[model samples]
Target chain A: MVVRGLAAPPTPWSKSLAEPTIDETAYVHSFANLIGDVRVGPNVLISPGTSIRADEGSPFYIGKDTHIQEGVVIHGLDRGRVIGDDNREYSVWIGKQVSITHMVLVHGPAYIGDRTFIGFRSTVFNARVGEGCIVMMHALIQDVEIPPGKYVPSGAVITTQQQADRLPDVKEVDRQFANHVVGANEAMRPESR
Target chain B: MFFPPLQPVSTVQSCVSGDVSIDPSASIASGVLLQADPECRIVISAGVCIGMGSILHAHGGDIVLEAGAILGAGVLAIGQVTIGANACVGSITTLFNADVQPSEAIASGSVLGDRSRQIVLDGRPGV
Candidate 1:
């Protein structure tokens, strides 16, 4: 990729992030943005107008067969979590088969589990989301723990553990919707021919 | 060439500075400003539609918009913002914090500056 030099340089922000990585099997749209130490997994669908920046945290990862849907933005955290005794640094980690909906933003040192569906215009900040969870539209998840298979209702804000624990279980149909997104995006890929 | 040319990749009188990464399938409309500061970057993902007159800037953090997302006209999302996949943000909306869930729809004329809070809108809201 060519980093075009401006006639008159605007600022020094251009080289903040290292080169991004996109797997061969992943479907990254022409207009999508992936900057700095970001790793997009196989069969993943990164839709139009989306952006993923890992400059601060470094090494943001998306698991296999996940869907990072439109207009989504992901930012890395200033401090990374240490995994076990290995001292491994982790910032933002999105699991496999996750569905991140439109206009959503994921900020800070967050961990989203596998097969989760984050709804439209929602915000997730510094939270830990469990697997197979359904975060409904306009929901806010901040510094909370969403147990596996929980379903957050629309406009629900989960600020504490009590609110997250009170949520219902994820429906089977909603999980299927997340699964179908993968195939649908492959069909929409440029090389689908 | 299968890979699109990078030279003149950005148009529409948009003032672009620093390091910005945009996917080929994404459409950056007119009157957009994409700027990156010393410690931040801008990455626009696939199938993204950045509406006209939108300003995406980064100061000390990065800006990333995931797949199938739409930033409506005159929108301003700055500093450590991550718009998730399939998200549809209405025109003139401003997002200051970070992280929107997948497929989330935000109405126009909205202001979401707090990362710990969520903005809820059903049908529409605007000036």
Candidate 2:
């Protein structure tokens, strides 16, 4: 059985509609930290020294079989940005089998689709990444919509609408990262030993 | 340097080789790793808040974190780096060879990788 090392926030912070939930099959490393209002799916691997804080504006959701690598940071919005007549808060969604690599930063309200690979040291801020996308290392994804199967090169900055329109589809060879990262990360799990 | 009162919530697990000092009223969160080389030193000044999983390594050079600097979660720093007073470093930022100016914000910054550097596009770096 996996130990639940995740902690609930203090009183005033807890008063928000934030709740923390994790599936029993997930693997969260002992050194990793998860703050309030985050939901983790099954077979997820939260690697060592990673922090996912949803204390601010959240109801963050991690899709099944996703892998959050070492030294990554994920935060909720400073305030809820989406306002409907009903005043409901929408969660930031990370889809199934996604690979959020080492040193990555993901800030909501962001939606990353299934089988996507967010490379090392990349930043995704207030963006929507479609299914099967590859965001390479050192890339900045801000306020954009990366279409399905798109491949963003390393060190590329996608901020302008023109730049978002100019992004290319993933090369066939690079699709391997999206295909294998989930199983590759699962091998690093302690129970796999 | 003199030590300050450590909060009960802070977790300090560091491996030191040389001189390392931290001021009082500093909050070093859980899972932080501080390493000081035999020759160099690491110093964290007052009112600094180091988020969880930050690695401060002073192996090749000295590290000085001035007063009121904030290091967000999963930040990595090494070498002769000085985070000036009241500066804020966002999460996953690496100051492997950096000198952040005081009150500067290094927001979601990262060093470029070998693949990005190795591309010989038109005989110059980057396309």
Candidate 3:
């Protein structure tokens, strides 16, 4: 279901009442909710039980071919904003071909670059993850910027810049695994619609 | 002066199921989910505010939210949990079998209670 945001605000932020703009090629499942000031790019698959709400935040952008798995939650704080790859301010910016696995929370102000794979149940809050990164399950990434192609192991907590910097680069096997997952999900886009 | 009484207008746009009781003064944002299994209950007291995209699932036990409790966006409260009155749980926090004290403040991105089963064993060094 897709709907409009709040018409008025009781707080300093959340003043916008804009509706979502979804491309025709995107497949949003019936049980998924996409509300207010959100832009869904082409060929994106929003699975069931997912919530992409931009009511408090002004705008969100999901690039083409990204897949948001079941029970994933995407929301943003009204106070902060991130600069997208396009150089504009956004509440959350998810780049092309990203995979947000089941039950993960991608809270803004957050930026996830292209081809990044966030594993199941991970939380990305107030952080910037560069292109081709792989974040494993149950990991918490907060208030940090991860360089491109980095690998975050499972159950790890990366809160500071030093920790993110010291992380190892993505292995070839991990990259292949992420690509495989993306490919598999992309094949299901037609069936999901 | 003739004044009309204040009418309680609480809006809930979430998907709710099973034995759930929501007070008329409670505010539930869009995309919030409340699921209670058989023989379990989820109670949202008066003045409670559940933020957008938060999920509350009661499994094998009751989940209770005391009056004026606030759950920020993307919070996941699973299993048995009790949030005391005026407790504020920040965004993206996960609670499992937690009993928050009254007026307690939980920080954002915090994971409280047991998550042993969810831990994944990665063979990578320096993790």
Candidate 4:
């Protein structure tokens, strides 16, 4: 369900009752919830039980062809934001073709670059994930910046810059797998709506 | 071109379900979800403030928020939780089967409770 944000004070960060702006090509499942200053780009698929709430953190951006899988929770703190690729400030900036898998949490100020795949049950908080990175399931990425094309193994806790820097590069199999998942989800966009 | 005053196009109220008792003086923000199972109960005392997008789920036990407690935005409390009087739980904190002492303060993004119980894997085969 897509709804308008809070109308009264203790208002949101934007201080206005901003409704979500979803591109016509995007498919938001009925069970999914979106509220307040959220921008959904073209061909994005939001599955059931997922919530993208921009009430507290205003102005979130989901780039085109992104898939937010089931039970994923995307929210932001009220204080901070990150600069997007376009140089605009956003509470959460998700780049094109990103796949945030089932039950993942993407909390701002967070920036996920293009073609990155965040696996199931992982948490990305106050961090920047560069383009083409593959984060395996059950990983915790907080307060760090991961360089491009890095690979984070499952159950890894990457909190400091050193840990992020020491991460391995994305292998060919991982890239193919991530691409396959994105393609499969994108194909289901028609039926998802 | 003339634009009207900026107002909400639609209003989504907080959802409260099943065996929940909230005092009239308590404040609940929009998009807050309070769900109690049939055998469970949720009691919200006076002067309690539950922020937007906070989720309180009482699965097998009761959840009680004592008087003057404050739950910041996006907080998650699940299963047999009791927030004592005047306690403040910060934003994005997760409390699972935990209890907060009276007048205590929990920091933002804190994850409290049993770590072993945090992840519940599906029982289905090949999952």
Candidate 5:
């Protein structure tokens, strides 16, 4: 499912929540918003100006005693854009007691483990996060894997944009048919070819 | 009458800072920012020292800084990465989508090791 933001940062104050789990002691912001098919654990705290949307591909799950800070965005995506069941598209999974701070964005087909803390303004797209991992603020993640109990310092950039490593040989496919129409009815007769 | 689940959108008060997720044992100086996404999870372990102007951002992914991790001022990190025990990240250091091994000291302007590098961190002991 492709959800387009009405504005650069859409603040849907009047939008009603479908079904969400929130603690009484937790504090969430006024400008922040959330969509349906999302699950939040207990003792979990949410801050203002944040938005979350769980794609039909996968369910968004947050663990107990976790905190979600301000200006953060979380969403699920499709693994295979054109061909796949709704459940097969995005396999994003978050472990128990994970911590995510402000201005952070996490895309689908990703997995995050338990007892980990993420810093501010970080970006993660299609990656795997192990348990007890610490991602510092302003770090960019592109198709990466964070080891268990490892730390990423602030402002680090990780991307597969430039690959110096040699890739396996795989030929690109070329289109074969420009326009070819063979009607079965025309050739069905004994004399037709 | 039946009660309903707390509406994330309907609530008037929203913002992570309003909730004190800071551990009592952890020492976070003034001007340090800790923010959490409403749809994700975040946690700061004990004995972590965040300098002034440092920001911790998390989302659906987990970000854990183990005990005794010292972050310099104005450091920025993103995504799901762990700062192991006793690791020191320099001031204004930027880490993108990677991890630093435990007890590693990474100097400024250095690249963080990836899967190809075999877990050897710069300025780390025995490196």
Candidate 6:
């Protein structure tokens, strides 16, 4: 059982015809904030203190039967979070049943394909997420296009140098942090979406 | 207004409004300053302890700690850097631009820079 947001914003108010339909069975946990016109599917769980919103003019979309666990946040800023509007068949369109976990932050414009499991506390900023990919917990995914059926291991920092450089770092400061610390992983098959 | 999960153990004063990820199980001593980008996200994992008078800033990027990761007082993981799972980082050391390998013991030191340079573990004689 999953809890969803307060209510889906009624369509006909925005210029974009496509609107999100949230399932009654999804779980949107405490302190989880949602904005913009995004679709949230069924059985999705959103944890505490997670904020999912779009900038004043854009929309964010989520698929059906997905589970976004506690503290998971997805948002779009200054631009709409885009999903499921592809031109080709088998060209990867967003579908039903995607799962995003606790404390994961997603920024747009971004596309997360169908039936994917984005692990806990993972950060996806400006990237294309493929289908059936298991993005492990605490992974930093930024500005990279993930192929379909790929498995991003836990704590894998998956961003380019350009994206990494965008974040500022103060010099000569005492810096010690866990997570994003490196480790080996066993080869595993991509989970089917 | 979300109060801390436990009793008011510490007080967060006025600062820029950014995301602060606090672990419920971990103890944060008083006078901790955490700054984050209102636009970006910040995540603090489980069973991690952040000591007193510490500040963690996440701007342009996110700050994350995995399960069971321990940080001595005043430790800072800054910018494009990641400390692996179950790794212990000593206090007062600043990590500017590097990723620490998991379970690789780091005793009170700073690891910085990318694939470009080697990290000279602080307090250890002879590079």
Q: All candidates: CA RMSD in angstroms?
A: 13.5, 10.5, 10.7, 15.6, 19.9, 14.7
C-alpha lDDT of residue B8 in model 3: 17
**C-alpha RMSD over true interface residues, each candidate:** 15.4, 12.3, 13.8, 8.4, 19.8, 16.8
On the 0 to 100 scale, the lDDT of residue B34 in model 1 is 76
Candidate 2 Cα errors over 4 Å, as ranges: A1-17, A80-89, A177-186, B1-113, B116-127
State each model's CA lDDT, in order. Answer: 0.67, 0.68, 0.76, 0.88, 0.51, 0.48
CAPRI grade of model 1: incorrect
lDDT of 4 by residue, A99-147 (tens): 9998999999999999899998999999999999999989999999999
Q: Tell me which of candidates 1 and 5 scores higher on TM-score.
A: 1
List of chain B TM-scores, one per candidate: 0.78, 0.76, 0.81, 0.82, 0.65, 0.66
Name the weakest run of 10 consecutive residues (lDDT summed) in model 4 chain A.
A2-11
Please identify model 6 stretches exceeding 4 Å from their true place. Answer: A1-21, A80-95, A160-193, B1-127
Model 6, A1-193: lDDT tens digits are: 0111223344354454344456776655433456555556665544334456543434565556555543344555554344454432211123556656444567665677876666445677777777655564446777777776655544456566443333222112111111122200000001210
> Model 1, range A1-193, lDDT digits (tens) per residue?
1122223223256476578788999888665667788888898888655667776766778889888855577876778552311235567878898888655678758878888888656788888898888775556788887899977655576777776776667667655544432232333344643
The per-residue C-alpha lDDT of model 5 at residue A124 equals: 72
TM-score of chain A, model number 1: 0.82
TM-score of chain A of each: 0.82, 0.83, 0.87, 0.88, 0.63, 0.61
lDDT for predicted candidate 3 compared with the true structure: 0.76
Ranking by lDDT: 4, 3, 2, 1, 5, 6
Expressed as tens digits, the lDDT of each residue in B1-127 for candidate 4 is: 1223323323378888999998777888778889999899999998899877889999889999999999987888999999999999987788999999999999887778956634335864223
Writing each residue's lDDT as its tens digit, candidate 5 over B16-117 gives 342235566776544444544344344556777765445555433456777778777545454456788888887645554467777888774333421211
Which segments of model 1 are wrong by more than 4 Å? Answer: A1-16, A82-88, A176-187, A191-193, B1-127
Candidate 4 CA-lDDT value: 0.88
- Pairs in clash, predicted candidate 2: B4-B24
**lDDT, candidate 1, residue B71?**
92
Stretches of model 5 off by over 4 angstroms after superposition: A1-18, A21-30, A55-57, A80-91, A160-193, B1-127
TM-score of 1: 0.57
Report how far residue B27 has shifted in candidate 1, in Å. Answer: 15
Worst 10 residues of 2 chain B by lDDT: B1-10
